[model samples]
Target: MNQLPFFITIPLPDWLTERLAVPMHLHDDEARMRFVIELSRENIVCGTGGPFAAAVFRAADGMLVAAGVNSVLRLENAVLHAEVMALMFAQARLGSHTLRTGGGIHELVTSCEPCAMCLGATLWSGVARLVCGATREDAERAGFDEGPVFAASYAYLEQRSIAVVRGVLRAEAAAVLDHYRESGGVAYNG
Candidate 1:
């Protein structure tokens, strides 16, 4: 028997790549919402990957630690969701595998509700909070195949002391998905 091996790579523009060098400070919830929406739009326009994107922030002051757009199609990796990418980048920037620090809380802000893999990543990311823009139904309505995420999934997060805020700037985020569908972007569900 033979075994096949695969690798993952995300090609980002110079500007996007430089985002890690500077600290992102989002003053309020509105700023964080705007950042996610813009990140989604940029992903679509720049042809990075999917229409979704995510950002990690310091829960204490809403300072953006890192941002990531989906790269599933670009990397040919099914688990490369926006939230996962953002968490990965955040960890890299902070030089820590976990986001939580001593007396400091981190937040995950995503353009849409997380699928199963991303949801699991969030739990393990060490972020103290999760804020989502669109819901699972919204993604399905846009023809993106999202993994099964039940209401209990959210309840479970809350049970674990992870604050969950859903449907932040939903229409704007959903509009990005609609645009992606209209633009005929590839919806690769692996």
Candidate 2:
């Protein structure tokens, strides 16, 4: 199979595909599950972190899988998370899951709470999973007209959702933007 280079090295689309179809979208369920774990490791405080902290995972074919976040991030630092979304998307693109390979593909995206504008980004990640952090009530309140809905957020704003996460080669996922001074090629594997 063909493998797309990592975001650092490859010329990824301006946006990832998180649409709804396969091969065209950006996320899926498997990736979403892993995203939950990734967010937890990032010290985002799943449920307690705030309302803004959330993760969105999709299939390689742009399918919505799972979304989780801490309500505090949403309530307090919406803009900060909003700005960091580009990072999250890049991470998701570079971060591949078992589902993202072969005839079957998968992808994921995660962020704290983001308003209407962010959704637009997920729509482009070319994945099947469409998941993010939102209060249970908020999810219910928002009511996705898309399809079968799942909750990645908390209801109490204090509750947390837990899921196992796994991924590919870890390069500078933690390092700050300045860390990549020379800018090595991406380690994308499928």
Which runs in model 1 stand beyond 4 Å of their true positions?
A: 1-11, 19-21
C-alpha lDDT values of all predictions: 0.84, 0.33
lDDT of 2 by residue, 68-173 (tens): 3332233443333321343344445456432333344333344223344444434443334433433223322333122222333223112321222322212122
Clashing pairs in 1: none
| Residue 68, model 2: Cα distance from true site in angstroms | 11
For residues 144-176, could you state the per-residue lDDT of candidate 1 as single tens digits?
Answer: 777778899999899988999988989998899
Best by lDDT: 1
RMSD of 2: 16.1
For candidate 2, the per-residue lDDT at 103 reads: 42
lDDT of 2: 0.33
TM-score of each: 0.90, 0.29
What lDDT score is found at residue 89 in candidate 1?
82
What's the true lDDT of residue 39 in model 1? 80
Q: Which ten residues in a row have the lowest lDDT in candidate 1?
A: 7-16
